[model samples]
Target: MAGRRRTKHRKLVDKIKEDQRVSSVPDEQNSAAADLPTELLERILSPLDLRNNIRAAAVCKSWQAVATSVRKSNRHPWLMICPKVGNSYDFYDPGQRETYSLDLPELKDSRICHAKDGWLLLSKARTRRIFFFSPYTLELIKLPKLQSVHEAIVFTAAPTSDNCIVFTVNHVNPMAVAVSTCRPGDDAWTTIIFENQLPFVSGICTKIVFSKGRFYCLSEPGWLGVYNTNNGIWAVLSVPPPKCTEYLPPDYWWKGKYMAEFNGDIFVVYTCGAVNPFVYKLDETKQVWVEMRSLGGMTFFANFLSSHVRVDLKGKMRDNVYFSKVLYYGKRCVTYSVDRDRYYPRKQLYDWGEEDPFQSVWIEPPEDA
Candidate 1:
């Protein structure tokens, strides 16, 4: 009786295993998804946001191609924020209204600078090493060493381009400033010294902007300089003295001057303490800085570090100045409309917590990505 019972139990166990194997056959056959057409797959992936689209690319070869094709038409600039806790950064996608975190061990303790073409210039805090990195692809390209780059730095084009040029300026003598230029693959940087026709007693450059195939800079005490990259020529533009009707001193104009370019024109913004900003646009044909009655369809984003950005929103954000520092001093951020001349606090932009104090800069999302 015991032998008969053992035989019966063995047969029951074998039947259960065979049924389980048969049930998994349909699951394996359905997993490949070979029947789905590429066009339909892209259409399905089109509605998803950028982060989800990245995940869909990892599904299979066919899905990867479809996801890549779909993402090309849906790209937007994301706000990057680095937190204090870990080796990662969070990007806020305003279009999707979502924040995605990217794990970038390479950006650990890095100071960011000069963002262009979806690439950010990073300098390691401890080493002061300068490099360019793409947050989307985690690609890093190292550049040669630069020292004493106090205020202004800019690039001619995207770092990956063959004709890309990087330029930076620093104070050499009391009245002179030195400009340094280099390409991505170059062995060393070439330095150019500009000491002639110094406009101010201390010609320290606060910011640099590359516009109309040339580099324009604003120095301390409201002096504007333009550098012709093609001919290696530098000239200082004669700016009229600050128009002050009050009892305030002349030193008030020296503090808050920044330069930016928009729609083939250059603009200069000066903010002294908490007064309404005074904006001037360079009239190239006249060789003068003309005070703009209105910004028309452009907005100027200026920072205390002398970095400024110009954006053309058609008529959406026109006639406004968005500054990283608040009026009346402090580091609070706000935007002021030149037309309405009203101040709007921009605390909502600081949704992502920062490791250091909050400062915002505008960067263009890379088109190639």
Candidate 2:
């Protein structure tokens, strides 16, 4: 009887241990999630925004593996500002109407020259040391020192790319402009000077944009200066502004000029204080500027600080040109209808009569951030 009892007790103990082990196993749903294939998981997480995607990544190891695989792209442009009251900068999303703050000690002392693809080209006071930084990821890349590039700078692509090219332009004189180019891995900058025979004023603002694998420098007097990145040749292009039957007004040449690429074509925009903005497209084959009556589905955002960028018509922001009204004690955000020739002033970005000193810039946050 005692032997039989011992055998029964051992069997019960073994059965209890087995049941406990089985109970500790994960549930069906969790097991399925953990065993979910990476391909399907990526598809599920692909539509999440940067913030939600981060939360999804923290769910579990399998979710993280899949979240990291989702490609980052299709980012909208955000407006960035560094106010005088704080060390952190504010990023405003136009679509969401939300603002995000990022702590960047590097930007406190440095000045921003250019912003694109979520990367900022920052220069320290007078030392000529430049750094490319991503505010989202806090990644930093030191660029070659450029002492003469205080006017305009442009990058062909993201600084993380191996074949990226950076171009800088400095107006040297009334008739001459100095340009510099450098690759990401280069320690020094290559300088090129383009001088025109005709004399003009020197202090006029300049703008640069990268399109069709070349750098287009739009300078004062409405000239398209072309620098072929592949061939390393510089060409000065003179495309006369719209024919003025009457004597051109004083603001004719003094108007604000900017360049933007839309639908693979480059355009020059002329904005004056009280006149309707003008648009001209480059007829590459004929080497002339063709007046554009309508922008179709494109919109333009121009401010006092950065280059003009092309924004596709979406929702309420359609077929309009947006600019900041910073004159006459005004700080209004105004949009112009290219088709209707009307100005619609939206809410002001700053308080009325308060002079905001920071240079406003639009930046496309990196997808991979």
Candidate 3:
């Protein structure tokens, strides 16, 4: 009986210890989340969208650090509105329908020429100074003063990178264009006059995109010009202009066009008042423009200064073209669906030509910002 009693007591003590360990597991798991390894945290948060990634950062300081370090390559673009009277700029996020304002005295009297990789290439007319600015980090990089204002300006990459190249082109004459190239650390821009073999008129309304070491300039009349950065050869592509004139209104046709490049494919969007915008992709192999009925799960953000393309967008955002215009008292952004063949929240009757080209722009935001 004494031996049996001792055995029962041992079993009871073991059961009690087992119960205690099970109860502590929940607390341990909660603590482990806060102390997770940086690599593991990055892996977990890297795939999340910008909104969720920002929300997760508020969980703890460790999470905020990890979120800041993750480079979200496919994040959505935000619309930045430059105020005419003050230094306060408003940024609109389409996904969240939220407007964020930031006081940027650095952008006072400055005009944004182009935006890519969260950096803005701005030109101040008063000072004739050209520089790069990051709205999120408030970082600024200065460039040499430009002798003449080249309205068509674009950069190859972020200003911080060694591969970053700033390019601009303007009409010197009907047959020639002044092409200027500069790097971030350069003392001055290198200007060259390239004579066009064909009729390619470049002006302040021209749009440009850089892809695969080449600069593709789309003239105001839809002519395509190609410049090979590697060999310094400039040629006009034989591809004909997209047939959008018939569908566009006669008054504001020139101001309604936007261009973007994604995965080496060039896309052009043509907008019409109260109508679905037409999308066309350039077939370089065939040297022709192909009208696209679908974006293949890609979303395009269109702006006068710069445009961007993103994939894997969620909900009603996929396969849509979002314009820089905000309507309904700044509560809703104008968006159009190519598949549905209609605009969200009804059609917009606003004329694109009347809008100020520099008043609003699409800017890529950093992951942490």
> How do the residues 1-369 of candidate 1 rate in per-residue lDDT, one tens digit apiece?
999999999999999999999998776654665458877887899897655777888877778888878773323344566566787666554334455667988877777767766777767656657888888778899988775553456676678998688877777665577778888987878887887475533333366778877887766655667788889987776754334313234654445556776556777776654456677777778766777768765667665333444432332344577654333333233566777755665323321112122243445554562
The candidate with the higher lDDT, 2 or 3, is 3
Cα-lDDT of candidate 1 = 0.64
Clashing pairs in 1: none
- Candidate 1 weakest lDDT stretch, 10 residues: 349-358
Candidates sorted by TM-score, best first? 3, 2, 1
Best by TM-score: 3
Error of model 3, residue 287, in angstroms: 0.9
The true-structure Cα RMSD of candidate 1 reads: 18.4
Off by over 4 Å in 2: 1-75, 173-175, 195-204, 242-252, 308-313, 324-333, 346-358, 366-369
* lDDT of model 1 at position 289: 70
- For each of the candidates, the C-alpha root-mean-square deviation to the true structure, in angstroms, is 18.4, 15.0, 9.0
Off by over 4 Å in 3: 1-73, 249-251
For residue 127, what is the lDDT in candidate 2?
Answer: 87
> In model 2, which residue pairs have backbone atoms overlapping below 3 Å?
none
Between candidates 1 and 2, the one scoring higher on lDDT is: 2
Across 237-332, the per-residue lDDT of candidate 3 in tens digits comes to: 888888876776566657788999999999999876766688999999999999999987899998888998888665668899898998887788
lDDT of each: 0.64, 0.67, 0.86
List residue ranges in candidate 1 displaced over 4 A: 1-79, 82-85, 90-100, 147-150, 200-205, 241-256, 304-315, 325-333, 345-358, 366-369
